[model samples]
Target: MCSPFTSLSSPTKAPSLEVVDLWFRYPRSSEWVLRGVSLRLYPGEVALIVGASGSGKTTLLRSITSVGRWIYGGELRGRVLLGGIPLEDLPLDGVRRSIQVVNQNPYTHFIEHLVGRDLLSAAVHLYGKELGRRVFARITTALKLEGLLGRRFFELSGGQLRRVAVAKALLWDPKVLVLDEPLMWLDDEGVADVVEAVRVARSLGKAVLIFEHRFARLLHLADSVYLLRGGILHSVEQDFVKKVQRSLRLSRHPQGGSGGRTTGRPLLLAEDLWFRYDKQGDWILRSLSLEVVEGVATVVYGTNGSGKSTLLKILSGYLKPSRGRLELRSRAVYVPQNVYLFFTEESVAKEFEVACRSRNLGRLCVERGVSYLRALGVDVDLEESPFNLSWGQAVRLAVAVATAASEGPAVLLLDEPFTGLTYLERLQLAESLVKLGNTYVITTSNSENLALVPSARVFKLVEGSLE
Candidate 1:
């Protein structure tokens, strides 16, 4: 195999994938999401694009696939080239066969209920069963997904789903592979697996492009790094990490002293809790006990499939425990992993109004909601649809709404709230959470964010038990 860098000086050599003078804007929006952005990716190399939330990184990725063009209803003026041939000249089937994309959300790529069926469908659709089976076996082994074949797609944990999504894409054996936020929800071990998988793909001579906010973890693996900002792409030296670190360094919030030990009684308590989605299925939680003190944040750290989200749901009264006693002293506001789930209204202001009204907070004051969001480093137009906000913005809005609903000391439950947040945004969120002075039960795979709340009680959830 030849090094991708060696061919860069040759004018006759064409890149595996190239984007030239690209500009795009969604329908009804005057602003262009991508402005005169161009990129080149060579075979046997991995490239990375890093940007803040809503910086058009995802939009650029969507443009490559072109399958969701109609859904976005955007005007695009760009030439996306594959091996020096314009994408417009290629047949749709040919384009699909040559370039494969795994979206930020693994669930978006799932077409079948069972993992085996999903992999088989991708295999059969791309290649005949005989050849597909051979390819599928290789992908499964490479991704370490042997035991997951028999499980249902929905039953798999976040990390498992991400691996399966990548496996499904590999079944097509595309020449170029693009992944959006592949490292978002992964734990340390999961991150290692993904990095190894990327290496394996590069070793196979595939051009790989990864769009991520957490570039530090994947920076070492990237052959070239580009920073996307203000809708423009800027090539940066491989020492991009130092530049990003300096830019994202924020003033540390004053550490509130350790949440003093409980004196009278715990605000929330669970004893010998047991839960499972199915009667005969394996228990997601077993004999797990927890206590949440008033006005103290509790951080639950765990890898995927460790029941962190399940425990939060049970505490929020969204899901009942299969057995054991669970008690809560106050109403808990549950913010799900997908922040969009918390929005029932069309616009951000309307959603806040609904939350205020539902919580019986008297007259609805949208200003309060706006202020809350602004303090959390989310400064978006209130009239904009919540659906249009970026992932980090939506999470901030959701947290604001949850905090607004609490008239007194309350319990706030958040599951993976920092998924798409930038370093500065995470710091802002941590500062806001500290100021709220409420009992927070938050789950995250990010250990760095935990330092933001030094006073918070921390627990590790592993194999249905809290330690």
Candidate 2:
């Protein structure tokens, strides 16, 4: 076996985590997802890996952490070393204790319903009661998770959920920290919180490996940067980060061309909206009200845990408001954060077939579905399962499916649809939505998204009401 690419000067000590000639592919798959990929992550340093959608960034991380073969049942070759010891030789629990991973979808790792209970319970079990409490308190404070402890897992905004997941991993005080899209779904403030956490981890001499598209934001702190292309890891300079981000534009259509705002009656109306999980609980939406007219997109912006998702649920008719007067003139389709749950069929073809049949699109449903996906910059095969698509692709697919009918819904509600999309993907999808001429109400934490749909009516959700 040959040594992998090393960008830095000679190391004084052994790497905390090293991948040597790693190759992996899922069972029954002819194509290899990772081809002889190798990299080394040293202690007290941050390594950033950036790649386009479906470029095998997640697969590489899974291989380095041994989740590729151990959990997913894939064919794997080569070695992953943890603390100079072969990863396969170490027990599963030991591997977990030494290296902790926080995935892109933070909700997947959450076991308990309540945030405080989950952290405290795991810490106590792993570090005993006294030490666990002390550690838990420190992590929560560092991540600014004190305000989120009382909330349930489902109640958290996407950014809050990610922070909690990071705290959960930090509670173990692992030697290495792995984050997949750590800055995803975060506003500026949320980004600062995560950056601070990473700074602290590095100061304590921990190895941090980040697999993300937003590497430019963290480039200042990255000791080494790599790009994963064609299933191979190539060393890249820090300036390359800016070049790649600028060159990823995939949009072919103009943006913000929605025939301007319509001067007709509102398609949907809500007044005096009030919502809470239970009567004893605090109100999530306090007498919030909104009016959405046809042919005009509405963008609602808010920080994490500001009740943006809850408001979308209420508007989409998925959650009944505790007390509100809502009137809808047409059908409403809601696409949520976990878009995979929106698909009931086995493959993209099957899912679109069902959608086409419902819309009376006849035998052309499959072909038309594929076209819609392509227009939004998602080009997955019809036979592929929706679950197999990347997070950004899945989100774009969900949006396409939600509006696939011959006559699209009168109102479409999206909850954090642009959470994980690249800059180009966001513009493409936003332009496509405008081209469709369907009324849309989207909730997002990123302010940059507002510029994507300039003609859209913009509002801020704060203090449980639209401001």
Query: In model 1, which range of ten residues has the least summed lDDT?
Result: 1-10
Tens digits of lDDT, candidate 2, 1-467: 11112111234488888888988899899899988888888888899888887789988878877788888999888888987889888898888877999887788887899999999999899889997887777777666678999899988756667778877887776778998899976875677767876776776567899888765467777888898987888988757755644543322122553433457668898899999999999999998888888787888888877898888777878899999898877778888777777889999888888987887787666676678788877777788999998877787777677677646446888888777777667766777777667788988876656667777777888889887
Query: Global lDDT for candidate 2?
Result: 0.78
Per-residue lDDT over 1-467 for candidate 1, one digit per residue giving the tens place of the 0 to 100 score? 23321221233356889999999888889999899999998888799898986688888887776653656878889788876778778888778767888877889988789898889878877778887776777777767778999999878766677778877877766768888888877776677767877876776667899998777667778888898998899998756566655543431222543333555447788999999999999999999998888877788888876889899999999999999999888778899998898899988888888888887775544567777788877778888999998877787788788877777667889898876677667777777777656678889776556666667777788889887
Please report, in order, the local distance difference test score of every candidate based on alpha carbons.
Answer: 0.78, 0.78
- In terms of lDDT, model 1 sits at 0.78
- Report clash pairs, candidate 2: none
